[model samples]
Structures are given as C-alpha cells and as structure tokens.
Target: MQKLIFSFLMALASLSAPLQASEPASTHANITQEVNDWLNTSLSNSPGAFSFELRPIVSRLKLDGCTQREISLPQGNRLVGNTMLRVKCIEGANWMFNLPVKISIQVQYAVAARPLAANQEISTGDIAMQQGDLATLPGSVILDPATAIGRALNSPVAAGQTLRQEQLRTAMAISQNQKVKIIFRQDGIEISNEGIAMNAAAEGQPVRVRLDKGKTITGTAQLGGIVDVGP
Candidate 1:
C-alpha cells in the first residue's frame, strides 16, 4: 500500500512540471533594442552629429522575463565617451545588466593657425576651424571664433592646438587711477558723477571707485571708461 501511494504522488508532480517551464524567459534581442532606443533619445540634443554602437550581448546568460526595463548611464557620464549603459528590469523581473558602448561624436572647434605668444591678442586670422570628437577634447573648447577674437591669451598656444574659452581674457575697460563717469538711473531719471577708479577692471567686471568726498563704491566697468553704478 505504501509503494502504491509513492507512485501516485510521482505522477502528479510530473503533470505540474510543464506549467513552470512555460513561464517565459528574457531574450537577447529585446534587451539590445531597448538599449538602442534609449541611446538615440539621450544624444538627440547634442551640439553636433554623433553615433554609437553596443557590444554584443552574452548569448548563454539567462534571466527572469522582464515586462518593463529602465535604462540609464552611470552618474557623471555624458554618454559620449566609451562607457557602460545600465539596464534594470523594473517589472516582471529583478535583474540588472551593464552593456559596453562605443561612441563617436563630431564637433567643430577653433584651433590655433600658428604658434601664439602669451598675452597676444587674438584676431580672425589667428585661428582656423577644425572638427573632432568632443569626447576626446577638453570640456571648455571654444567652438566659435567670435568668442576667441579680440581676447588676449593667458598662455602660449602651439599651432594646431584647440582653443579653450578660459585661455583668453577680456580687454580691460577701466584703468587703475583713471577718472570714470558714474551713472545712476532711477524712475527714468539719470544722474552723473565722477569717481577715481581704484583698480583696473574689464568690461562687466567689478571695480572699486573713490568719490569726491573720500568715499568708495563698487560698480561694474563698461565701455568708454564708464562705470555703471546702478541697475
């Protein structure tokens, strides 16, 4: 009687096995598609044209079937450099994946036409346009020639070197100890006063000025040695 009961239980277990096997599994193609869709959206607003390719997915790895997926780049990554994109199943499964990516971005930037000296003022002839991948270049590379022209370089630049925004300085609008016109406007009324500048400052830069009565005030330097005393 005991052997008969054991045989009956084994038959019932076999009948339920098919249901578990049919539950489902995640496929490699679906995961790769999700990554491609996400990458295209993230780079849509970049300054220049870009392209990316994902490394081949592991074929033998298996995970729970995913109904929904969450994709993101690691923090501090802009998705332009060779980096890893993370895919996590937010529904129907609890698995995460990291896929390697190869990126190529093309952007136009200014490069020095010839060797330049420190403190040399820039002109239109000083630089030429060049194109390269933004990921491998400096973060602050100057893309517009207008931004670099008329500004003085803080350090020497070799020919073919990329021009950076911070390497140039704006022309000074006010000289130290120079007399400047102080302008103040309120309710459409304008007032003009004279002050002695205490320090040299470039346009839009703060400068200290001493008034006639030995008083000092801070104001922004402007064109023609004018100091804007009020908004």
Candidate 2:
C-alpha cells in the first residue's frame, strides 16, 4: 500500500512540472507576436507601398508577462530601407530591444536615357521611366518625366543614371548681360528702369542686374526677362 502511494505522488509531480515549464514558452510566443504585429502596422503605413523583410530575433528572451509594449523608430531614422527599431515593454520589467528591418518599395522614376551634358536642356527623349527600389536609390529621385523634361542639368549625367531633383533646374529664363526691365513698387507708386542682367537666372529666382547708372541690384526674375526689385 505504501509503495503504491509513493508512485502515484511521483507521477503527479512530473506532470505538474511540464505544465509549469510551458508557461514561459507561452509568454515568449505572445511577446514575439506583439512585436511582429507592431512591425507590420508601422511598415504598412509608410510613405510608399513597400515590402518588408524582418530578421528573426537570434535569442529568445524570456521576459515577464508584459501589460504594455511600445515600438518606436530611432531618432532621425526614417521608417524606410534598412533601419533599426526599438521595442520597449512599458509594463512588466520595462525592457527594450532593437530590431532589424528592411523595407523595399517598387518605384517608377525618371532616368537619363542617354549621356546628358552639363547645362544641356532635358528633352522628352532624354528621360525614361525605370522601375527600381526607391529605398536603394540615392538623393531625391525625380518621379515624373514631365517634371524632368524642359529642365537643364546642373551637371553631366551618364546614361542609365537615375535622375535626382538637385541635379536639374528650370532652364534659364534670363541670361547674363541681357537687357531686362526692373520694376519697383513702393507706397502705391510704380517705377520701372532698364538693367543689364549680371547673372543668369530661372523664372522666380533671384538675379543680379546692373542698372543704367552702373549700380548692381538683386531682384526676382520673372517671365519675359523682367526683374522685380523692391524698395
């Protein structure tokens, strides 16, 4: 009778031991799910439509049951491309971890169809739409061919090179040493004078012009080579 009772007690203890161990596993699974859900939500609402690849956490961290978990991007870090994100458990233990994430967005942007020379005006034929991952590209890429066409290149670009906004500018509406009408308005009075453009400029940009009296003045360039100067 005594031996049977001891055997029964041992079996009950063994069963309870496994049940107790499973608790930590369940908590770990819940933490992973929470982190994944946060990542999916953040990536889905990013600037462009992107596909994301998340690296698996190397080691399983057995944290306490968390009542609250917060995920945030690192300072100055855009939620795009390869970046690190910080996840913190605000409740239970208040622990944090950094997660590695990769984001890729398929984009159609303008590229140079041919080798373009510096100061060359971009024509319709010079720009072509190319499909690529925007996250992997550099600088502010030009998305539309219409925006690139009719603009002058600031520097020469090789064929197949991606077009960037900083690389192009509006074609000069006013040229250097050209005649321009400088208009000024003050106190309801309008004045106009003829000046020579000392520097070339695009429409709506500032230009330096030499007045008829040989004095240099800076004014805003307008259409038809007109410069507006303010008193």
For candidate 2, what is the total of clashing residue pairs? Answer: 0
lDDT of each: 0.89, 0.83
Point out where model 1 deviates above 4 Å. 1-23, 114-125, 146-152, 184-196, 210-218
- Model 2 Cα lDDT, one tens digit per residue, 53-105: 87766565656545677878989776678988787878645577887888788
- Model 1 earns a TM-score of 0.76
Candidate 1 weakest ten by summed lDDT = 17-26
lDDT of 1: 0.89
TM-score, predicted candidate 2 vs. hidden true structure: 0.73
Off by over 4 Å in 2: 1-26, 45-48, 144-150, 184-193, 211-218
Candidate 1: tens digits of C-alpha lDDT, residues 1-231: 999999999998999888667646878898898789888888898889999989988887787877788999878766787888988989888988788898888999999999999978899999999999998999899987999888889899999999998899996788899999999887899999999999989899999999988999999999798998886
Worst 10 residues of 2 by lDDT: 22-31
Provide backbone clash counts, one per model. 0, 0
